[model samples]
Target: MSETSKMLWAVLGAFAIGFIVVGLSKQEESPEQKEAASMIRNYVTIQSMANQKCPEAILKQTGEEVYFPSETVSDKETYITLKWVGEKGFKKASCTVYGTLGGISELIIDDKVIIKKKI
Candidate 1:
């Protein structure tokens, strides 16, 4: 092959290899990151328990703050979304807390709210 052609092929190969290596390196999730994701999920689930009327306890345990986001209603039932914001990957989470007697709470994460509607 001509020298110029060979050089061009080598440059393209290097770029391709660099992209592959970077992608592989980023595919591995650190233990701390995994833990943070799990914590976020748990935080959302626990906040949903607030419908039972005592979310503060769970919030303290998780060390996450709950914020009221918004609400939606259907068939005379209301659903409330609540957001929990915290550390690492647990930066945001959404949960719904609904009451049988017409109480509603909303959890918001970013622009989305996780809702639980009372039936």
Candidate 2:
């Protein structure tokens, strides 16, 4: 092959590899994203309970924090730990929430609950 043709093929190969990488990246979510989703769900659920005026005993646990989205506006990569207290039938259910604890609206779960911590 001519020198120019060889260079063209090399460039094409590089482009193909880059394309594959980008496509794969979009299809596969990072661990951070999964964690963020989990955190958002827990926070929203627990915040819901908090709004219901549940007993402090039900709200206090290993990972409990009063999350204020307004305070985290400056930092986009903030991580927060949230505690959700609740009861399911006879068993007690508590959730520990953590994620890219940045904004009140950034984290969304199933298009149902907005991450805005309900007062």
Candidate 3:
């Protein structure tokens, strides 16, 4: 084989190996990243639900402040708690979310249950 052909094959082989390594690494999602993603999804869900259920309770300009206090994971399920505290229009209201990793179980605003889904 020509020297140029050998060089090209070597570069292609290296590129293939690098691609495989990167693909394998990307397939394995870290637990922390998975948890963060789940929390983000929960936050979006809460925002949508609040907009639909209690539009008056949602802030207009900056929206509500979301904080994740705790996350618990078991073999069967994962639990994440999100808290939002700020002024809801003219009143000071707080929303606490009890979210499962795959779904939302409950959402409470100002100590009132806004949404409760069966697990």
Candidate 4:
């Protein structure tokens, strides 16, 4: 009816459209990021692994310097099964010699990371 009323309605419509567009775009923040931002915190520690090789691979890999996992937590069907390592109570561990490589991949001990290089 009036010019002022028409302009006000047009501006309101434009704002509604803009809000819709912005809401949709902001939804793409990624579930991983949102979950990480929750009140719960996550920790990631490195561990040793032959990835399935031998025990000495651990020593040789770490140059006899790093702490081996004393306990074991392995998955019967995978290459990574260690739970926690480098704590109190160190123990005598075993190794698997798979050809030229000799280390423990799923040792379930200290950190699952040891190598002629440390993975």
Candidate 5:
């Protein structure tokens, strides 16, 4: 092959790899994301069930101070602990996750045990 053709093939190969990387990354949801989503869903459900007993659930991401857009987090790479601190201290609900969308093994709000499943 001519030198120019070889160069073109090399560039195309790089672009193809880049596209594959981006596409694969988008399809895969990080474990931390799955955990956080499950945790948040649990939080919302408990809050709604409280129905005036508990206030809005405020997310407390580990290692984050505060920011706009659901508040930024310094640690978003790993499945760190998350707490849904009940607003105004009316209620507090937290969970020990079972698996990816596997449901919470335990949920405690206001020092009361809501759910506890066997290991």
Candidate 6:
């Protein structure tokens, strides 16, 4: 046909190929990647809670300074701990994630328990 039609077809073909590749790559996500992603999401939720409810405990620093020392995943639950030191000695938040993101079962900040859900 015309040059313009040929160019359009070529672009469409490239777009289809790119979409297929992306879909395949996503399907190939390993168990480790999935677990990491879940942990990250759980961490973000915990941080957001800290920012909203206990802003004073959260110290101001580069994001790199935030540390997660513990991460344990069992068949029934996943536990993640986020710890950082602020002006007031040590600060920490521990999150227990359950049932494929059903909701955080518990979130403890420092010595205080912020969220404690039954089962």
**Highest-scoring model, TM-score:** 3
Clashing pairs in 1: 80-105, 80-106, 81-106, 81-107, 82-106, 82-107, 82-108, 83-107, 83-108
What tens digits encode model 3's per-residue C-alpha lDDT throughout 12-102?
9999999999988877788999998887776666555433433333333236643332232222223434444545432233332333434
Q: What is the TM-score of each candidate against the true structure?
A: 0.30, 0.28, 0.36, 0.27, 0.31, 0.36
* Residue 98, model 1: Cα distance from true site in angstroms: 10
| lDDT (C-alpha) at residue 63 in model 6 | 22
User: Can you write out model 1's per-residue Cα lDDT over 1-44, one digit (the tens) per residue?
Assistant: 99999999999999999999998888778899998887666544
Residue range 16-109, candidate 5, lDDT tens digits: 9999999888877789999989777765554334322212222232222211122112123222223454445424455444333344445556
Model 6, span 27-92: residue lDDT tens: 677899999888777666654543343333233222223333344433322433344443343455
lDDT of 1: 0.52
Q: How many backbone overlaps does candidate 1 show?
A: 9
- Candidate lDDT values, in order: 0.52, 0.42, 0.51, 0.41, 0.48, 0.53
Q: What are the runs in model 6 whose C-alpha is more than 4 Å off?
A: 1-5, 55-119
Instruction: Report how far off residue 23 is in candidate 4 (Å).
Output: 0.5
Q: Go through the candidates in order and give the clash count of each.
A: 9, 1, 0, 22, 0, 0
In angstroms, how far off is 86's CA in candidate 4?
36
Which structure is stronger by TM-score: 3 or 6? 3
Could you tell me how far off, in angstroms, the CA of residue 95 lies in candidate 5 after the best superposition?
1.4
Model 2 lDDT vs. the true structure? 0.42
The candidate, 4 or 6, that scores higher on lDDT is 6
TM-score of 2: 0.28
